[model samples]
Target: MIELNVAIKDKYYENSETAVLSQLDFKVNSGEFLAIIGPSGCGKTTLLNMISGLESCVGQHISYSSNSSGNRFKKNDLASDCSKSEYLENEQANRIGYIFQQPRLMPWLTVRENIELVLDPTQFNKIEGLLAEVGLAQKGDYFPSQLSGGMQRRVSIARAFAINPQLLLLDEPFNSLDAPTAGRLRKLLLDLCREKKTTVVFVTHDLQEAIYLADRIIFLSDSPCTIIHESIINFPKPRTESGIAELEFQAKLTRQFPLLLAGKID
Candidate 1:
């Protein structure tokens, strides 16, 4: 099982102290998808940064281990090692993969080349196979500018998975696409991640997206955020559009939305 533990002590902006995130704690196991949502400026990204080790924070620890024993509350003494730290640190070279809000592909590179960019020289064939897995085999020769937004995002997804990273971090990966495309991509991603046994930490505001993809939902409060509520996605797999709403997953999340947004109705 892949496990993640995040604890934030304190962080400041400039001379003034700002507790963007404080005392945050959560764990995710292998093949498990976790979603985090909150209002803007609520430090949701800040929390992700700490977990990804992009920014340093006080009083927090981020640790990873394959066994469940490695995920417990006990602090990992090995976190201090430079190599281990680099591996766990924010978006390590190939061990941890990130899919940002935008596709961010290089305009000059074709889809195949873009995916192969991160791979080792000997691994180009692996990249070809991954593009096929993501249903982009036919578009391999197309550049980012030549493809639709959804297709570009698909390439981004393919690149993230090509190297076979242990942990995947997605920051609103499906934000701008049309509903149908986003839904399709979501299912494809879930299936692929499951097959790869990769632990995913997805950040999104869409409740349905969270319900359909995550094993659990962690909701954060407004700025200076901490976990406000958490719900386990107990619904059976092979989720569907109509059935997902019928299962009360949406309603359950709606009931918590107020608290999640710090009591704001909007």
Candidate 2:
């Protein structure tokens, strides 16, 4: 299980010193797909950063309880207490794979090289298979510049999975893509996640995307963001846009969207 309860302060804006995240308390089950939806500038990325250990908090902001050992590991002291290697060596620490809003591929490296850079040397054999899995079978020699934006994002997805992470964090990865490209990427992501059984936390402003991709959806209020609605998506997996756009499914979400926006969820 994953647990988080924290407050965030913006040092640059001291005049209005309210916490960016007033009270965030939630838990994620192992191997679950959880999507967080909120308005822009609502601290969604901040929450992901905290979970990934990119941001530090003074108190007990995040904790991971391993199901096997029943041991709880805290993130509060990570930065100050351990070196990068030590942290990775800790059995309780989660191996994280993050896909940012942009592909962020290395401009100088070939597609294969970029993916290879993050994998263990022993796992080099898996690179070709992953490239093929992402539909870039013959493009391994091409650099980021040679690939289209959508292809580059595919490379990024392949790279993230190359690490064989236990937890995956995605921050609006499809935000800038066109509709058709985004749809394909979403399906690719779902296929990969199901194959790997990785616990996923996806943050996005797109309601349809969240509803289609997640096992459970979390809705947050505008900044000083907090969970206003937590909903289970009963739709079966391997969902497609056509299926989600059906009148019945759309109507169900339409009715819930207003309550979610109004923070009227029980």
Candidate 3:
């Protein structure tokens, strides 16, 4: 239930001088399901890496203030009490669940075992319920090779939620699945997010998918990425992809930002 404030001054890959990301800053409110969308190779993944502390950040300033409402933190609070590296390292360790573009599962391990890889031995009993939650109740003994792509992704989702992470980061977890399958999984994810109320920052290139799943959407430019726009999805929860409201909103958005889906602000 921690709010995330991401201010990535810059990110440069090894042996390269050009910045893959620059001056990208945003805040993810606690329990807010947020999405990031942009053009291919636009540093979307890089930004997620930085937030998850998988990549180095050029500048990070972190702090928190006490509050009575039980929301003890605010976004980008620069009290200088901790460095960017220090804060991300100390606060996020063992508390983050990251779902990558691929399932990244071990072929030899059973679905139950893959999930157990992240949990304590005592928490092993939670595996059954987690598999059931992701629509894999009967497939716990199946390995990654036996399940379909969508099913494997389900296992991945189950594994991520197994930790009951305070923050969940998804890098286009449903990207490669078919529409029918992807839609089903998106609903599954939405339900889980609601039930857990975990803070989520999902990265994707699909605008419609973002609208369907996120409470707020952050759109980025091509490279040396920065926030070009942010759309707040005011639609009620449990939304449908084909709902008139969802379609109409999309139409209006495309008309307003004609090249938005193309990753162009103009």
Q: For residues 204-264, could you state the per-residue lDDT of candidate 3 as single tens digits?
A: 9888899888899988888888888888999898898978998898888899998886678
lDDT of each: 0.76, 0.78, 0.82
Counting only residues 3 or more apart in sequence or on different chains, how many pairs clash (N, Cα, C under 3 Å) in candidate 2? 0
Per-residue lDDT over 1-266 for candidate 1, one digit per residue giving the tens place of the 0 to 100 score: 45676655555555666766666777877667899877777777766765666765433566766564654444342233335455444334327778889999999999988988988888887876788888888899988999999999899999998878788999999999999999889988988888888989999887777878888988887767777788887777778865845358677667756455452434
> How many angstroms is residue 232 displaced in model 2 relative to the true structure, after the best TM-score fit?
0.3
For candidate 3, list the clashing residue pairs, or say none.
none
Ranking according to lDDT, highest score first:
3, 2, 1
Judge candidate 3 against the unseen true structure and give its global Cα lDDT, from 0 to 1: 0.82
Please report how far candidate 3 places residue 166 from its true position, in Å.
Answer: 0.8
Against the true structure, candidate 1 reaches a TM-score of 0.86
* TM-score of each predicted structure versus truth: 0.86, 0.84, 0.90
Off by over 4 Å in 1: 14-16, 68-94, 244-247, 256-266
**Per-residue lDDT over 1-266 for candidate 2, one digit per residue giving the tens place of the 0 to 100 score:** 33333334331123566677766777777778999988888788878877787765434335554453555554423333355665455434656789999999999999999998988789989999999999999999999999999999999999999988777899999999999999999999999999998888999988788878998988888877778877787768877776734446657766767656543454
